[model samples]
Target: MTQPSPHPTLTPQFCFSTVALRDFLRISRASIDDSITQNLNALYTPAGQGFDPSSTSVRAPRPQNSRQIAPSSCRAFKDQVLFPSWQVRSDVLNYCASVATSPDPDDPESVLRQVESERDRERVVNERLDPYSARFFPREARTEMLAAVVRQERSVEKIIRARSWGLVGERCGGDFREWEEAMNEWRKAREK
Candidate 1:
């Protein structure tokens, strides 16, 4: 006869059900959806009003005699704006997908970290869109906008600067290089 088990809870008696798995996935998806909505809402002011175009607080003085620059050629727009923005967005989405599907998806702390990472990635997208902003904005307005960006970045510097390379192995599916490269891309974009 077999001896009594020391760790009965570790036995194979526990059952897995498709219903449970489906419920878990549904909840996770809802949580992610809420997070996306919250982030989008955070872009607006507390009063629910967006920046005022008529307000000169952030606007640059326009030269009375300045002529409007012609719109970018199709090739220039594709090369300079569309493709680069798409690549950055694609990289971020791919990174998030890898992390979400990692082995420890059940860990709550890891989930929080992933959420913070997504926010940082969103900021990178904002910075990447700066060139697109330049298409219609004045030089001084661009400078002021960048300064605001820098200020906001400083507020989140601690979170952004924290890099746990050890966790990257588990988070990135046993390879940290992909995560490192993606993070470097974010940093490089911010530098510009």
Candidate 2:
């Protein structure tokens, strides 16, 4: 009797031409991107205005250790760019703590979970400390926001395209719609 192979081999159920496979993949990616864009729009539209810093005027003290001398609104916007509010911070910290403490120390999956939790906790703490840091901004909006805030006049589209910064900057829920809304709010505030 023939011995069964130790490693399982995957057999293709159907043959696909290279072009067809590429097209399918392309369509799948586009569908996912569109869904994400739609969801972001729904979650952060006209009603979710409070979190936007550009829409309000405040004379709050400068954030600790920040060297930015930009307009107060801009500074305020940057301050709340990460995590949205204190509630998010608390929840994130608690979740990370739970993940770090509840797992078996010797299990590989548990070890990885602990390490990831520690890293996430550290990132959240760092973001809380310096939300204005460029590293916290999404790739698509980072340079554009910097340019606008610093009053630099230049086309950012070419740069964004060259860098291939995904069609919809979804990092940390940051997207073009949010960026556009923030920009419009800032412009209106500036005009006042």
| TM-score, one value per model | 0.20, 0.21
Q: Evaluated with lDDT, which candidate comes out highest?
A: 1
lDDT of 2 by residue, 1-192 (tens): 111112112112111122332243234333332243342333333343245575468667764423222244233432332112212222333333333344223333445555666765576435566776425322222223222422321132223222222323432223444443544464567569
| Candidate models: Cα lDDT each | 0.34, 0.33
> Can you write out model 1's per-residue Cα lDDT over 71-97, one digit (the tens) per residue?
232223323432243343334333334
Please give the TM-score that candidate 2 achieves against the real structure. 0.21
What residue pairs are clashing in model 1? none
| Residue 53 in model 1: lDDT | 62
Worst window of 10 by summed lDDT in candidate 1: 4-13
